[model samples]
Target: MTNPEYWYNTRTGEVEKGRQSAWTDVMGPYPTQEAARNALKTAAQRNENFDAAEEAWEDEWDDS
Candidate 1:
């Protein structure tokens, strides 16, 4: 199968195809343009949830 054709340029918040910039400045191999466009928001949401979960876990440990 071929690789995904869409990417999210984290540095510029642009949805594009192939490599438009350095690998470190982008985040995707998203299969659809819309998914690439929402990459940063999605990442932020996931990070927030993860941090919340980590905080809860730490609180549980602290109460032990």
Candidate 2:
């Protein structure tokens, strides 16, 4: 059997066993409850990393 998925409810800051909240108010289908619980932290880190990468890419192609 496959492992159950967990989701982080952004609206309520709760870790749910499945898609218990609206899609727009949830973070993910994490493999574990702990991972789901840290969803906001993970998303923030990912956003920071993505912004850094995008900045580097833009700098590489800057003509001025």
TM-score of each: 0.83, 0.89
Candidate 2: misplaced stretches above 4 Å? none
Q: Can you write out model 2's per-residue Cα lDDT over 1-64, one digit (the tens) per residue?
A: 8898999998899999979888999988999999999999999999999999999999989956
Clashes of each: 0, 0
Total clashes, candidate 1? 0
Q: Against the unseen true structure, what C-alpha lDDT does each candidate score?
A: 0.88, 0.93
Give the local distance difference test score of model 1: 0.88
How much is 48 displaced in model 2, in angstroms? 0.6
Q: In model 2, how large is the Cα lDDT of residue 17? A: 95
Candidate 1 residue lDDT tens string, 1-64: 7765788988888888876888998898888899899998889999999999999999999999
Per-prediction CA RMSD (Å): 1.6, 1.4
Residue runs of model 1 more than 4 Å from their true location after superposition: 1-3
